[model samples]
Target: MLVELLLAAIVLVLLALVLWLLTTTRRELGELRQATAPADAVTELLRRQIEAVRAEGRDGQEAVRREVSDLALRMRGDIGGLQQSVASELKGVSTEVTHQLHEGMKLIQNAQTTMGDRLDRAAQVVAEVQGSLGKLGEATLRVVEVGKDIQGLEQILKSPKVRGGLGETLLAELLSQMLPQEHYTLQHPFKSGERVDAALRIGDRLVAVDAKFPLENFRRMLDEGEEDKRRPVRRQFVRDVRTRIDEIAKKYILPDEGTFDFALMYVPAENVYYEIIIKDETDLADDPIATYALSKRVVPVSPNSFYAYLQVIILGLRGLKIEANAQNILNDLARLAGDLDKVREPLRTLGRHIGNAQSQFTEAERALDRFGAKLETIERKGGAQAELPEVGS
Candidate 1:
C-alpha cells in the first residue's frame, strides 16, 4: 500500500511540473509574437525548446510509469509470499493451541474425578467420627454411673461391722473353694466361748484363721496426701494391725483346743496386706508389722497367699490319704497271703488222691485185657470139641 501511494505521488509531481513548463513556454511564445523585429527567430527557438522539453517530459513520464509498474509487480509478489508464510505459521499455532486445550480438558476431568473420590472418603470419615462421638458420650454416662456406685460402696465399707462381715464372707468363700466342707469349720468356738473366723483341720489338729481386721486407719493413711499428715495415720494403722494380731494369737492359737501353734490372720485386700508388710520394709530389717505378727505366731496373709497356703495343705492331705490307702493295700495283700497258706495242705492232699485214682484205673484196664484173652481161649476149645463130635456122628 505504501509503495503504491509513493508511486502515485511521484506521478502527480511529474505531471504538475510538465503542466507548469508548458504554461511557461506558451507565455514566452505569446510575448515573442507581440514583439517586432527578430521575433520570428525567437518564436521558432522557443517553440523548438518547448517541443524538446515536451519530449523530455514524455520520456520521463514513460520511465516513471515503467518503474512504478515494476515496483507494483515486485510488491505484489512479496505480499503473496508474506501472506503464505503467515498463514502457515498461523496454522501451526492453531494446531498447537487445539492440542493444549484438549490436554487441559483431560487434566480438568481427571482432577474432578479425584476430587469427587476425596469428597466421598471425607464424608465417610465424618460419619465414622460422628458415630465414635456418640459412643464416647454413652461411655461417659456409664463412667458416671460406675462412679456413683463406687461412692456407695465406699460408704458401706466405712462401717466396721460391714467391713468385718465382708471380710468373713470372703474368707468363707475362699475356704469353701480350696478345702472339703468337713475339713474346715467356720466360726469355730473355743472353751472361753470366743469364736475364730475359720479353722482348718490338718490331721487331728486345727489351724485357726481370723479374718476381722481394722481397716479404717489404713484407709485414712492412704487418703492423707501429705507425708506428715499420713505419718500419724500410718502409726495408728500399725497399732491396729498389732492389736488384731495379738487378739488372734491369744484367742485362736490354743493348743488345748487341738489348734496349731501358729494362726493365720487373713487380710481381705492384697493392697492392705502390702501396706502392712511389703510397704513397710526398711533396709535394716523386714517390715515391723510382718515381723511382729510372726513373733506372735499370727501369720498375716493376703487372699493370694492364703490360697497358696490352702493349696499346700490340700496337697499334704492328699499325701496323707495316699499313705493311708497304701497301708490298707499292704494289709489286704498280707491277709490274702495268709489265706493262701492255709489252703496249701488241702490242695496237696487233693493232688495225692488224684494220683492214686489214676494208678487204680490203669490196673483195672490191664485186668480187663487179661479176662478177654481167657474168654477167647475157651471159645476156641469149644469149637474143636464140636468139630470132633460131628466126625463121630
Candidate 2:
C-alpha cells in the first residue's frame, strides 16, 4: 500500500510540472507574437526550446511510471511468499500439537489399565483376609471349649475310682491310637483267671500294662505342712508304690502265660512316676522304690514315658515290615538274574548261526562271479567245450 501511495504522488508531481511548463509556454508565445514580427529569429528559437522542454518532461514522466510499476510487482511477489511461509509454519505447529495430544491419551489409558488391575488385586486380598478371620474366630471358640473340659477333668481326678477309671480310659485310648487291634487287647484274661489292664503282643511275647495308681498317700504327703507328718506320709507313699510294683510283678509277669519277664506299671500321672524314681530329698534315707521295682521286674511308666515306648514299638514294627519286603525283593531279583543268564546261552548260539550263514553267502557270491567269467569265455569262443572242475573238488 505504501509503495502504491508513493507511486501516485510521483505521478501527480510530474503532471503538475507539465501543466506549469505549458502555461509558461503559452504566455511566452503570446508575448513574442504581439511584440515582434512572425518571422523573427528570436521568437522561433524560444518556441523550439519550449517544444524540447515539453518532450523531455514527457520522457521523465514515462520513466517514473515504469519504475513504480516494477516496484509494485516486486512488493506483490514478496507479500505472496510471506503468506505461504506463515501458512506452512502454522500447519507444522498444528501437526505437532495433534501428535502430543495422541501420545498423552495413550499414556492416560495405560495408567487407567494398571490402576484397575491393582484395585482388583487389593479387593481379592481383602476378601481372603476376611475369610481367614472367620476361620480364626471359630478356632478361638474351640480353644475355649477345650479349656472348660480340662477344668472338669481336674475335678474328676479327686475321686480314687474315677482316677483309676481315667487311667484305664487313657491306656485304652493310647492303645487304640498307636497299635492295631490284633497287636493289643484290653482286660485280657489268662489261664490263671487273672485279668490285666492291657497286653501288647510282640511276636510270641506279651507285655502286660497295669493302670492301677495309688494316689491317696502321695497326695497326702504333698499336702502335709508339718515336716514330721510329711516324712511319715512320704515313707508311706514310697511303701505303697513298692507294694503296687510287687503286685504287678506277681500277677502280670507270667512266664507260663506267654508274658514278658517284666511288666509295665502305667501310672498315668507324671508326678507319681517322678516320686517313685527320685531319691529322698530330706534328712531321711534315700528312697529305693525304683531300684526295688527294677529288681522285681516291674517298670513304672508315666504318660509321657508310655507314649515314647509305644512310638519305639511302632517304629520297630515298621522296620521289620520294610526288612521283610526288602528280603523278598532281593530273592526275586536273584531269580531274574539267573533266568537272564539262561537266556544269554541261546542268544550266543543264534549269533554263531548268523555268522556262519553270512560266510556261506559270501562264498556263494564269489563262486557265481567265477562261473559267469567261464560262461563269457565260452561265448567268445563260439560255444567251444571247456574243461570243468571235478565234482569232488
Question: Which candidate should be chosen as best, given TM-score against the real structure?
Answer: 1
Task: Give me the overall lDDT of model 1.
Answer: 0.90
Name the candidate that leads on lDDT: 1
TM-score of each: 0.60, 0.51
* Cα lDDT, model 2, residue 114: 89
| lDDT values for all models | 0.90, 0.85
Candidate 2: tens digits of C-alpha lDDT, residues 1-393: 676787688778878988898898888888878998788588668868887987887787778778777877887888788878988988998899899999999999999998999999999989999988998998989988988998887677889898888889999998999999988989999887989999998866899999988888888898899988898888788778778888898889998889989999998878777777764443446447777788998887888999999998888778877988999999999999999999999999999999999999999999999999999987978744445555798
After superposition, candidate 1 runs with Cα above 4 Å error: 1-140, 281-287, 365-393
Estimate the TM-score for candidate 1.
Answer: 0.60
